[model samples]
Target: MCAEALALLRQQEPWFVSLAILGALYVAAVAYRLLHTSGLALCLRGPKDLRRRYGAWAVVTGPTSGIGRSMALELARRGLNLVLVGRDPGALQDIAGTASDTHGVLTKTVQFDFSLVSTPQGEEAMGRLRQAVERLEVGVLVNNAGVATPHATYLHEADAEAWVRMIRVNLWAVTEVTAAVLPGMVERGRGAVVNIGSGAAEALPSYPLYSVYAATKRYVSQFSRSLCVEYRGKGIDVQCQAPLYVDTKMVTNMVTRGGLLSRLIMPTSDAYAGAAARWIGHRRPVCMPNLGHRLQWCLCHFVPDRALAAHRLRENLRQRAVFQLLRSSSGEGIGGRR
Candidate 1:
């Protein structure tokens, strides 16, 4: 009887250990999924109406064109005072003038190259911005300046310096501006931040040339969520808006020459801007402009790695075809003059 019992115990031990290991993995995966899903869900919720309780000012970077310009216009329409930042003094002045004349709101234009935000001069520039807004009672910050590069084989080959510049503008500049305004907002107990992220941050396919850009955006996605968590209870709202290809000069150029695939996924910048405005007012942590994009994100969350990779490869090929067509229609080959 004792010998028989020992044999049974030995057999059962292996099965028990295997079960334990499987259970541990399952728990870990579930925990990770839950955390990721929850964080992002929070980002999708829009900003609270702190404006009614406390009148607000909005600072928008890259306000010269595209979504940034649209956001500036929308904010001004709401009777929010504006501090418009961009590299083009002429364009910035134009935007400020339009906002002031049309909306009857105070508008200040600061001309500086946000591409240099990681440098000492950039720090000084930001300081000047702080001084400019010191008396305006700023309550909202929009980090919207960004740039993208055409695809390249080697990451180092695609103007490594420009990649660094993009990082400074897209990632570091947002961080600096947010940090600068945070204390003031916190002290006042009311503020909001809107970070413009890319749908490419979802890690979908056919963005070989945009790997670095995507990676930086992914950082923004995570950072925005984390900031939301840290600042939610303090009457501060941090939100990220990720949109698919917008019908701005950038995407217009891409689509005109790019193949059919580019046309299929192209979205309008105004649409994205409108969605962002609504989300900001609502205090959503993150907003996806397109319903299709939301579904894609959901699918990516649970799909197997191998299957996802294959799907992305196909999409890349389609995108490449569109890019090729765009180049041809523009009367140039790839790498030719625009």
Candidate 2:
């Protein structure tokens, strides 16, 4: 056996050497790509650099909480003034005040709900938003306002109104808000639009129970890609940052029920905001800033879609059970966003 193996090795020596060379080339290519990406991150490290590239004023939708709040604060810390939009007037005012005092930047709060954009109420809000931004040198627009289903719900189980509201918040708002801001970015000749997406769309092969939410995010990712190609020549940078779970009210209930592995994988909203802010002006059209999320995205290519979907269904069912239990216990609001 040893002599036979020795003869085989000798016969295949040239192929072995060629394989070694190919492996070395692949490693070198990967290293070079990583280095290039790091260099871009360092060069465009927000603060004054971002202010110069995009302008000094930014408009961030849904600036009152979670990732939206953190992104607004991060940008303000980088020297850009802010125009904050949210559904809650009081919360919007509070955020505006805090941003100004803490970051020492000017802030204007636009009180509007993205869910109402197709109605008469939305018209009044739209007019207000236009007036607020028309004269400013708005450099960055963060389309961060979004929603998920109140709980893990199947499409058939979800009410028509519920799905409509989700569509408005998750899909319609992203499109209309970008439309509202893109013309201004074009006129200015330089700007960034950062849309917040989810790992349900980018990192996973299939999301079972959260199908509609994932579908909406998939659209956002594609929209961002097309927008990048369309506006790159016009000096507009379009990016969709797809993060996995983050420590936010939207998933507070679900993650709590999702066990230690789930908790460990989630980034704090502040941490995610920092990465998202740093990567905005980089040329990546669709990206996941969290390292864990990026790893999961790579693994997904090797995973069978049916298996992934089954695993996701189990996770969602657990979340659904927990949410139902909590709602029944208190007959009141739980820890997640509706």
The top-ranked prediction according to TM-score is: 2
Poorest 10 consecutive residues by lDDT, candidate 2:
38-47
Candidate 1 Cα outliers beyond 4 Å, as residue runs: 1-50, 150-153, 203-207, 256-265, 281-284, 295-308, 311-338
Query: Candidate 2, residue 118: CA error in Å?
Result: 1.1
Error of 1 at 158 (Å): 1.4
- Per-residue CA lDDT of candidate 2, range 1-338, in tens? 99996677677879896887699899999887765543444445533478988999999998889999999999999999999999999998998898999999999989888888888998898889988998898999998988885578778876788778778888888888888888888998999999888889987888877788899899999999999999999999999988888888888766653566664478788887877777777788998876656666767879888888889999999988887888799996453332
Quote model 1's TM-score.
0.74
- Once all C-alphas are superposed, what RMSD does model 1 give against the true structure? 8.7
The list of candidate 2 runs beyond 4 A from truth reads 1-20, 33-48, 256-264, 333-338
lDDT of 1 by residue, 229-251 (tens): 89989888888888776667555
Instruction: Write down the lDDT that model 2 would get.
Output: 0.83
